[model samples]
Target: MAVTFVLAFGGSVLAQEQWVEFSSPRDGFRITFPGTPGIEDVTWTSQMGYALPARVFTVDRGREHYSVTVADYRGIEKLGIAKSQSCAPGAETCIGGQTRIVGPGYWKSDVHGAITYAVFMLLRRHGTPTGMTWNWAEQVEGTLLQFTNADQSRTSASIYMHDNRLYVIEGDVPKGTPEPELFKMSIGFIRPDGSGSNIYSHRFRISAACAAATLSASDRAPASRRPPGRVSGARTFPASPITFRSMARLPTAARFSRTTGRCQSCGGAGSSR
Candidate 1:
């Protein structure tokens, strides 16, 4: 139910609210504000054909997200690559065309969803308590960009920057693009006009509520063993399971931190027990 945003921030300032290039793996990504550092790198992989994505949030000391594999459109819905124009497909026109906002469920604290596969999601703030529609069917450079929109119908920006001027590319979230998979069930299908277009995937990732990360034991370890024939150092965690109980209810040992005068906030008033 929590939607997290993964905004790109590597580019030269263009005009007012745009930039000339973008932060990308192939293109080299970087975001240097007083905020968090850039991610050292992102390594995504699939398990049993399902995705088990993991990445570090170098931007903030303690932040992370998950991702999955989804499809792209054109002709065949499975491979995810557009086949041709004669075969108008998912999220084609309706997604690219201007539409009226209609859905009204963003009033909640967290929101996440997908376009076609109905699972990719973002934070609740990205939507309106009411929904909207879109009409973004425009052609640029021979590659028809099926404009994407939310229930609010706000057109999606290319999310990339290029040249002295900002550029917006339209299409499926570009194959292999990383996205959270937590909300892959709340989105609805909308091919109001079969010819317009639709977008969906077998699976997509959605960000969850940002919580103070409890140090997972694996975080302390470096990359574990990898699969046969796969590149080394992809940094996947072992699929071990463990549980934690609140220290309050169970009688526990007392400890102290020389730096902070607190016991990890387990006490009633967060003072010495």
Candidate 2:
């Protein structure tokens, strides 16, 4: 999706700019930005105290700021193993018997708790959290937060974890402006082939291979026996009733309206289709 802006002066259109879709295959995600965004590589310290690699893609339109941060957690298990190996003999800080610095499946826990940790960091910002809720975009579960900044600017943020990568998306605009829902809604997970996961209605699932690598013996229990909200390696997600096949039959706007119960373009707050 694209947003076009035209500047008019004296009844004449002077200049135009477009918000174009930007895809980062390396980062495994895509989003729309007012222009090409600046990319920066940085080290991110996870809540579990592991130094992970991260990248930030940002674009500024006047006073408004938009950014998506991708933090890679793929190497966390290795880091945990190294920490455990480096622990002193009979160290009290080691968990799960004295042999490990961290518990079994600690990386999985870290990945699962990423969204909550990211949301906590956002809440710590110099802003008042006006609203927060569990939200899903393109079938990926996440948390969404609305904040009123100290300067009265409004900010909307969403955090999601997919494929062991944590995504933090934020948009801040001056007060009284409509929420930057377009930027927020445009987030899409990308495949290696450059196709977007958003093109289909499917829930994010951890593959059996990933489960084999990450799940500890205790985490391999039956889904019913496992604790609620715990990640299950073998669990299967039910297909969404609203499939792309059915949506393709409807008009574009009608499809979005059917899914959201509101106009996609206007971002209004009514149940009108």
Candidate 3:
């Protein structure tokens, strides 16, 4: 939920766009948002008249050895497979950062092979002439296991994403490549003070992730300015718009004080009118 806001507001969301490779930060090792591998390091330019995608939220770690990220693309959701595979995740398991089975589903992409497992998105191994691409959101809880068969693999790098951001967390686990092992989670952040932080350093990994949000009118603003998809994952949402109002745009000043029942949406996540 928090990450959703970061992307929508930080400048990534738009009417619907394509992926753009980020520049700068020189060069560094890339991990699958291992914490939440997704696309980042973007920038927003004012030359477009309106806010455009511009910033580097997609994080890479390890100091210039590799690159991993999460990318947003198109996909499909199937149901019958859930019956055959039988890994329906319940409410208790939805919390961020824990290990649970999602569905016996998979993410099939032309880039990577069929990364089958128990989750919503698939982490395809789509390597290009320059680098590799793996798309999936970061796991809040329940590790997302990506198993291989034997040794003799071609690529030495990878990436992943969850919610809406990508992460770089996994390393070349040569020892347990084929076996069913838990996927490693990580924590990366852009703090309120405009600083960067990776919550999941080499010492720790995320278990179950939880992000709270205010999901009301959203479309009126730039998509990125909103938040990540709903945490609850409701397929259907009310068709409304979230508008950004400027004080100067108002015809007259309608002033009031906090003590006199002023601002309407002023409280945090829990309070209400």
Candidate 4:
């Protein structure tokens, strides 16, 4: 699976930014934050009267608040493996005494239902919603819902299921927050041990590869060719060989730009070429 990264940029004005890795051993996930985020403990009570211990990692930058709320479900697996009747009796390949099966489609459905209900409850707390939209995409492997409360404040959330945990990426920003969808989709769930999950490993690998590619292109210039006190100028760097076929399945607004020209997103003068 090719992971697509989305970044929301407001106006031209930029702030000092630094990206760092934040890992939560308790939650069994890690993510990159633009700045150091504060951690808070909270309780998430489900509709079944089960109180799930959760943690919220948040950072407030200007008017945008980035938060990743992880609710661990290992104590009680909500969407867990079940016996499959299709397996032949006494087959050596049987898992846990029977064929254990759990499909991604089912996982998405269950997670989406839970998230949509939560959104509705939140709206009720703040009065009727003036507008709202619910979305689910297989390509993205997640469900995203956006709503505007009676107060006009916009809150968007993207939910993803990994292992026995639910990752709720919540983004609360003013209407001026640029590309709100980008921020909503930016919350990534990294593996605690970087094993047992190809998606987690793949994401980190892509990030490393992209960073290396950028640095490699910059170092290609010889000392004599580089102007004094000036970073290397833009040059043709071999395009990333990685191709995300699934991203092509996404809407135009969420797909990647496959151009050798200047990066339209950042206007980097051919930096992304």
lDDT agreement of model 2 with the native: 0.65
- Residue range 61-163, candidate 1, lDDT tens digits: 1122112222221111221212222334554332222211111111000101123112122222233322223322221111111222353233221221111
Q: Where does the lowest 10-residue lDDT sum fall in candidate 1?
A: 102-111
Error of 2 at 134 (Å): 0.7
Best by lDDT: 2
* 1 versus 4: better lDDT goes to: 4
**In model 3, which regions exceed 4 Å deviation?**
1-67, 72-143, 152-163, 176-183, 192-273
Per-residue lDDT for 39-158 in model 3, tens only? Answer: 455422211111223223332232211233332212212321332245445532222112112221321121122122212232344222223334333322223334332443222332
Question: Cα deviation of 97 in candidate 2 (Å)?
Answer: 5.0
**TM-score head-to-head 1 vs 3, winner:** 3
Using TM-score as the yardstick, the better of models 3 and 4 is 4
| Candidate 2 clashes between residue pairs 3 or more apart in a chain or in different chains | none
Write candidate 4's Cα lDDT for 1-273 as tens digits: 123222234222243256566667657656666677788999876443346678889988777677888775544333223322343555433222321121221322233345554565556654334445544332224566666655566777677655546677766767655535665655545456643233321111123444343334334546454222222234333333222211111222221233321122322211232
Candidates sorted by TM-score, best first = 2, 4, 3, 1
The candidate scoring highest on TM-score is: 2
Tens-place lDDT digits, model 2, residues 1-273: 122323234223212136889999998899988778999999888887789999999988778899999998878877767776776776645322422223433554566577888998999984999989998776677888899999899999888877778899999999888888899878989887788764322222323432232223224445455323322244332222222222222232321222222223322221123
